[model samples]
Target chain A: MAETVSAGASGGVLGGRRSRQEAAWGYLLIAPVMLGFAVFFLIALGASFYLSFNKWDMLTSPVFNGLDNYRDVWRDGEFREALVNTLAITIPHIVLRLICAMGLAMALNSNIRFRSFYRMLFFLPVLTMPVAIGTIWKWLYDPAFGPINSFLRRFGLPEPEWLSNPRTAIAAVVIVLLWSGVGYDMVIYLAGLQTIPREYYEAASLDGAGAWQRFRDVTLPLLTPTIFFLSVIGIIYSLQVFDLVYVMTRIDQTNQLPTVVYYIYEEGFRNFRMGYAISVAWVLLLMILVFTFIQFRLQRRWVNYV
Target chain B: MVPKFSTRVNRRSLLGAAGGASALALTGMLPKIGSAQDASAVEPYNGEEVTITYGFWDMAQEAAITAQLEAFKVHFPAITVEPQIVPWGDYWTKLQTSLSGGESFDVFWINSASLPVYASAGALLPIDAVVGDGGVDLANFAVPLVEMYGWEGVQYGIPRDFDTIALFYNKDIFDAAGVAYPDDTWTWETFRTVSEQLTDADAGIWGAGLQTSWQENYYNFIYQNGGQLLSEDLSTSVVDSPEASEAFVYLTGFFADELTPTIAIQQSNPVADTLFPAGNVAMLPGGSFRAGTYGQADANIDVAPLPQGKERATVTHGLANVIWSGGANPGAALELVKWLAGEEAETILGESGATVPAHAGLQQPWLDANPDMNLQVFIDALEYAHKVPDPVVGFEWQIKIQEVVIEGFAGNIPAEEIGAQAAAAANEVL
Candidate 1:
């Protein structure tokens, strides 16, 4: 018995030979994916990193021009404008998305009629193609012919040109971003909500807590981890917005509806400044890293794994 | 996706066209074909069974292009040709990535705007073989069009077709408004006054839909106003002149007075295939290529001379077939390029009514394709049409000009400040 106990402890849960053979097969099965990752991701990452230092138009051979591309990015007024626009989008999107998702998750988590249908309805946009989304919304916001403007006109309200006006374009984009993005956050929040024990709510109720009080004391504290995860990911992804902007409102990269990725695209492909675009991409990566680091540092104060 | 109206590329000006003196001088310097026995033959097809890819935009022209290729098959049966048609918006993006990755079509359509940039970058294969004995004659095509494809005396492309800008007006609207059709008699004041007379805002109709394109609208006006976009040397922007400022202010009055659709409405609804055909606008200053689509629309449309400012001027641009330097079958590609530019293929292209063939004397068929419309106005305008002035760097500066021009059209920039701002913006990019 003592020998068997020692062998079990030494071999983990499986027999030694069986485990070794399984491990070997597991590695063999995963080798192709690993090779793909190394070739496509790792190698490309290194090449792009090296390219960030060189002056290349992708038509001719790269010439090593250290720090010049980076210096150009630092002074790029378009990039600064793109950053401001991205933040303008990211902050409001994150806040509104969290609130809307939490509200949806809570409503769906209760004994609501047709709960599954409502949940699926909200999540459908998440599954739809961004290009399709942009195309539909472009028509929807069409000032002359769109249903939205028609509805506003019928109500005798002012109808601002949604995608064309610089001031209102970002607001329209955020509404879309929230509509397409909130469902994903809601799904995550639903998982978080379920994890919070009913015992907490019951205990709160016994302590003479009202619905709002119970939600404040019990539901809010427990959902911090989910909120933190969503925010960090949301900022990183939203900062790189290109598809919706490119499809819906990409009028002129220098003036109207310029975003960071769009700026990179204009600089690299359109402007034929591949090296400078790579430098911009690296700056974006560093920004994401700093943002994530700050979020992680700030997480300790609010996030509760318990 | 909103279909782009300016498919007729801004052949923005071609090289060797600064003046008549340079043109004559270049005529002498053009590489001689038959004089040298050492000159290579263009037909380099071996008995090898191989395939070559030909990429282009404009699916509307596929049938004609295909018919030409089928004719190419009668000569070289061993060569299998594949046609890749990417949309205009994605064509350049795909071209860049594919060329960089060493996987691109053997031959593709190129324009003056991109030809210089690609040639300078060494991305284009020099078609010297096709410029020599037993090949097409350089003198057979228009001098400016031919010069548009040559870089440092090495030819890189063959002119496929040409387009000139003109006024496409709804005859029904003109008749309804009891206004005369746009003709050579009209000037800037006439255009504006007629626009004001034609506009019926209560019916949600604007007089015109000025496309927010530098080539289609502003370039014509700027040039017609005797305003040069660039100096004679093509080194600096000259749009800040009083003539250009006046023209800029004149064009904006149409927009400000609601004679034309606002930039916002045009963004979602283009003037060419959408609003103009739907009878929401009275007139459109568009490229001649728009006739193919407009002819199919249920409207009485006709073309007339673009009302001149100081001179009867319009911007003419052309597309050329060029071989990619990285193509696997250069011999096959060259053979296709030479054959495509030949009279036989041009006849087929013109007969199909896809566009006006660049070959001399083959434009009659395209003209007859739309007999109702005065398509002759396009060929006639060629006399006064200026090539899009392409700098050695590229036409990317045009984008900068457009960014400022769009705001100017939106009535955001003050009239006097708009021209100077556009000049400064273009100079910054240049």
Candidate 2:
């Protein structure tokens, strides 16, 4: 018992001293990253929460204005429009991302030619920076001079204003979002597809299941866990879409495809209404938490451990 | 000890006072601050070596700005100056964050639209401490610009350069279309008629390449038509006025008539950087700042005064170099600001043809840099140049106005509705 008690800090017997030194080494090794997290992430998180209830313009010290920022957010026409845009972006992005990722995963799962080449080709967008992707896409979407409109015009097809028109802008943005985001989900789906037992598909086939039936019964249920993961991740990421829209859709200060995160950025940084921006951020956090929570709860119904 | 404590107190309170417009009465309201020569028996600069950062937005002006910084080193060998170049899009946001973080650049270029915001926040140091005998004088610079940088009678900045509106016509585009080159005698009606003549719908060539931009495009027309964006006190917006409406209609008609490149095309091919340089447009109503850019463009272009509306008027805006109050070294920063205001540095700015120097009678180098083009048209317009209203509330309304204007130029908003919607947008902020 005394020896066990010696496991505590400082100036003990040889064994205890060794263990203590090891513990000290352990803490010393982690101290830099831990200190960094505490300073940057945790402190910033706390400060953001604190700033939510204030009227701070960054230039001045914060003035506590209670629930006014939150109250005003409820009626903020811009916020509502942004939230709707977020939903529009998220739903299409999630649905399309999952479908495309699953299709690609299944295609790759088969013994195909140039398998690694195709995989790398598909995964390249995920590796590329969003800003780079946005800039390239912005050029592609340029109305009069872009290759896309030129292609359409060559065929005498009516080319719609891709980034500027309100009617087509969101859809145009979501298409690019899908192109950039689907690759990450596809790689995850491919890993999940490989994890499923080959015997399950064999058993379904032996039980008179066709290719369609085998896929529906064996592959679909097994991939539910992967689907569940991508859904939650897709919802979180798409809900907070910023850089792509910022680079691609903005015309000076006017954001053509305004999303919630972009709105938060504009309010805090551009407008210098940081207190109000933080409140919107907190609302978005709460929304993401609720969505993730609901997804977790719903996953219990359909996600098969088997 | 007492003097040091009082100086610190004055600085702290000055920052607080500068944070609000209500404090902008007179510097006399606050005690004389910063390097008050007589107040300290001790030395302010002990020949200390300090490295200070200078923030500015224009990459086009970087060459000239670097030349100025190189000169600054010669003047004060101990003070190593660094240029912190942020693009115009990100400059304000970064400046605001850097200030609040207490890691701001020592000196930076500030436009008039943003001066009131920064000055009111006390983020700037009054160079008045450096503005006496044997130091810089306020009278040497452009008077309106000197006033533009002043907050409550304490000047926060020294004017670096000013720009006035001019019509830059591509001689190639004009020649191709068999259209007469624009002259000072041209009026708004003539501009419209020339635009009609120059436009070839079957080809991609446009008659004009005007943007819904504030300074370069509409603001000139609005001022020319005798309109004001806001009332004198800035208590309300007067965008609904008939004069403003007329200007909006006249400018939007170019887009409505499909004479200029659509806003959609301009999004990718900005007028200054691409379209005008590419010679897709016959004429461009742009700022004098574009002279450097156009001077280097592959196309042959010459500038004329903006065509007369109700009266021949243009929008004149200037940039001023300011010292950040929150910087690590204020005294060293003050030395740099003093040198920047001197004629030698201003000469480099002019000679580089980056911009027209705000130092009176320094326009010769910029004009000579592009002798073939009518660069003097920019200087002559300064006689009738108008200042854009900087509202006490903020500049967000200008963004709002520009949004409505973009909508108008895109043909999304009807010509008649442009005024009401734009007025409503400004009213929201004002």
Candidate 3:
């Protein structure tokens, strides 16, 4: 009996050692990714945070400047303009995108002919690069020689200057962003629509419900989770809009379409105010964080996880 | 629990191996520092096989610059020069990051607009000692450009090439309108009258493409009208002065009168450059650097002196070759800069007709490269050329001024009001 107890204790020690070895191997397998995250993301993020409180011109060593950069960001007229423009573009973009995407997804999700072909067609814009899309759309909105203007002239209608006019420039940019982004959102919604069991609709029909009534009672609730997901992602993406705005507008016209990220770029790279740009970038981060938090809080009222 | 008799030594060895592997991977990814050679001890052409990198922005000039580099090899056979071409959009950002990171090129191209920023930061090596030791004559370059690259009695750069604006006209449109060809004797009134005659609204052709740009179009007018973009001391903005308002009125009148394409139309369509070559515009004031592209286009084009406003004035800007302060090989870099700014490289650059070399007497070759156009007009305009403003906060002020001026041209506000606003905004930055 004494020999057997000693043997059992040795066995338990061996098992513990084996499990610990497994844990080490698991960590080893993930080491590359962890290292990459530390070096590229974590280190850079920390540096940016540190630099926000200093004065740097990107050519010399940074000098400690306390909250001067933050103060400058608040006082800058261009930064205020950028903030207002960003909100104007992002809010409408999310609402219009959700509506248009849901409509397209509903049509495509129905028992229609050539559904895959239609899906491919609708998803084509998402595959094209943003720069290419922006460039092509810029030409399309050209006031004098664009096809849109030509069509307007054919109809004997006055063609308003779309991009050059400050009053219409932001609207034109929103149109381009919507054109490029709606495809991705529609694909997501279509995926969501397919997950709804056919029995739910059939039962609603058997109960003498009309099409709109069935959609309101069944499809809408089922799609709320997807809508919630997209809204969160869309808000974050739209707030950081840069490449499209940069490609579409010149500095003179940027007031109409300026975004916080683009302003950060102009300050850091063009104006050589690296520290100030980082400070503005931190403000953008805080704004996005607060917005995302509010979204999470609001989702409880409307989002249906089931 | 039943079969826990495995070897404990094996697990210990495996953990050790994993830790070692991670450490190895991380060490590979960390940035290596203090690896550069001690360049101070190395004399010029001491039979050392030193490799130095040269960074420039223009891809179109690569072939000509490559040829120049090959010629440079003949003088310093042991040294190898690697020419890196960063596109214009990303050049400054990359240069800034690399310089701050201590991995910058040995030598790079700098511009008048960027001179003060880099020079003041001590990121550029002052080349006065090198110029003096080599007995390189600064007088060989255009005086304005030499003065442009200088800051606080220290010359930081050697001018590689210069550009001045001139009138580029479509000969076919001129003949069709029956307007006399523009010449040196033409005044502002003559230009206005000819532009009016050349305008054909029914045909959708404009007399000229009047862009809202400050450098290529309006700055010349401002200087000609005795209005300075900034005070002589570079301490204040004087764009609100009456003389500047007159210049603004003259420039914006083209759009207001519909003689040129509306600001909206020009903003959408090809502005002056494409409009002129596409035959949509009869005349355009463009920089000499555009000569190559304009020469290649399928159009009967010619250049003349810019039509005089109150006086004959043009804005001149140029690229300068400077040595990086962080370079590992200052001696070799200085040698390369001197060779590039010398007569041979300038001759090669001029012969290619890529740009007007800043070397004073070598411009004739650039003119001869394109005999079909009056390229000499650009050279002559240099006599009265005003250096584009190069204040410490130049890029910021320039962008602000452009914004207000574009608003004026778009007719959102009156020209005088725009001028005053622009001056106020610029002065705030200054």
Candidate 4:
């Protein structure tokens, strides 16, 4: 009886040892990735934070000036312009993207011929670089020789200066952004639409709900979670706009389309004020965090997780 | 104890040790120790393999530069010269980052706008000692160029080539309009009259494409009108003066009168460079470097000196070759800079017709390269040529001025108001 008890104890001990060895292997597999994140991301993040409190011109050693860069950000008229422009661009861009993406996604989700082909066509712009898109759109917006102006002229309509004029430059940029970005969000919405079980619609129909009623009761509530996710991400992305503005507009045209990230780039690289750029970046980071936190808090009221 | 140590040395520990070792090696944190060389004596080439990189930013002159490099090999057989060509848009950004990283090129191109920034930062090696030791004559180059590259009495760069603005006109448009070709005696008033006569709104052709460029357009007008962009000490802005305002108004009048393409039209199209060559514009005030491009286009074009305002004046700018202070082989790099700036290299550059060599008496070969047009106009303009006004952080201020000038050209604001605003903005930076 004593031998039997000892044998059982040894068996339990051997099983425990095997599981511990497997757990060790798992940790070993992820160690390199963790180390890389530590070195490249976390360390660089800390360095940037440190740089925000100092003044560095890239030519000389950094000098510590507590909160001066941040104070300058508040006083700079250009910084104010950039902040206002960023918000102006972000709100309209998000609203437009949501409406267009949701509407197109619903249309595309139906039974239609060439569905995969349509999907690929819509996703094509996502594959193109922003610089290439900006350049092509710049030519398309040409007032004299572009096809847009030519079309307008054929209709006997006066053509407004599309990109060069301060009044219309931002609107032109918004149009290009919509053309390039709506497809990406549509794909995400389509994925969400597919996840809705058919029974929900059928049940709603049996309850004497019309098409719009069924959509409002069945589709929207279920898609709220996806919508919530997209808005959070979309707002963050919109606030950080730079590449399109940089490529589409000249230095003289910046007043119409400058965003926060573009301002950061101009200060850091063009003006060689690295410290001030970092301060601007930190402000951008804080703004995004607050926006995302509010969205997360608001999600509880609208998002249905069933 | 030995048996226990052997048991602890497992495969995972061994692999981790190796990975850490390689990471340290790859990061270049390990110290390097080498024997010191004597500082007093200059070392001659002793058949050692030395490779040096030369950075420049002109894709159009690649072939000419390659030929020049080939010629350089004849003088120094042991040293290998590698040419690195970056596009103009990305060149300065890459150069600055490389400089900060302590991995910059042995030598690179410098310009008046960027010379002060780099020289003041101690990123350039003063070449006065090298010039004195080699007995090179700095007097052979244009005085403006020499003075432009020198900061605080320290000559940091040797002039490689120079450029001046000239009036480029399409002969087809001039003939079609029944107008005579522009000459040296042409004044601003004559230019305005001829441009007005040549303009045809229905045909979609303009008399000129007066781009909102400071160096090629407004600066010439400002200087000709006897107005200064900056005060004598270069610490204050003088662009708000009445004379400067008059120049601004004169330049923007072309846009207001529809004699030149409006700011909106030029913004969408290729500006003057394409407009003149495509026959959309009858006249274009452009840099001499554009002669090669215009010559290649399918248009009959000719060059003349810029029309006079108060006096005959033009803006001249040039590129200089400067040695990097962080270069690995300073001696060899200085040698390369000297050779590239000397008469032989200048002669080769001149013969190629790529640019006007800064070396005196080399203009003949460049002029002879294309005999169809009046290339001598550029050489003549050099007599009253002024260096582009470049203060510390001049690039930023130049953009500011362009912004204000563009607004004036758009007719959104008056010239005087814009000029005052621009001057105030520039002074804040200065």
lDDT, candidate 1, at B314: 94
Q: Which CAPRI level is candidate 1? A: acceptable
- For each candidate, what is the lDDT? 0.83, 0.82, 0.82, 0.81
Task: Highest lDDT: give the candidate number.
Answer: 1
- Interface C-alpha root-mean-square deviation of candidate 4: 11.7
Residue pairs with clashing backbones, model 3: none
TM-score of each: 0.91, 0.91, 0.92, 0.91
True contacts kept of each: 0.37, 0.36, 0.31, 0.23
Model 4 gets an lDDT of 0.81
lDDT of 3 by residue, B30-122 (tens): 222223233234455456889999999988689889999999999999789999999987899998888767788889999998899888877
Over A213-232, each residue of candidate 1 has an lDDT whose tens digit, in order, gives 99888999999999999999
Off by over 4 Å in 3: A1-15, A251-256, B1-45, B268-272
In candidate 2 chain B, where is summed lDDT lowest over 10 consecutive residues? B33-42
TM-score of chain B of 1: 0.89
DockQ of each: 0.27, 0.23, 0.30, 0.25
Model 2, span B313-397: residue lDDT tens: 9989899999877666777888788888888999999999979999887889998888879898999988998877786566888
DockQ of 2: 0.23
Model number with the top DockQ: 3
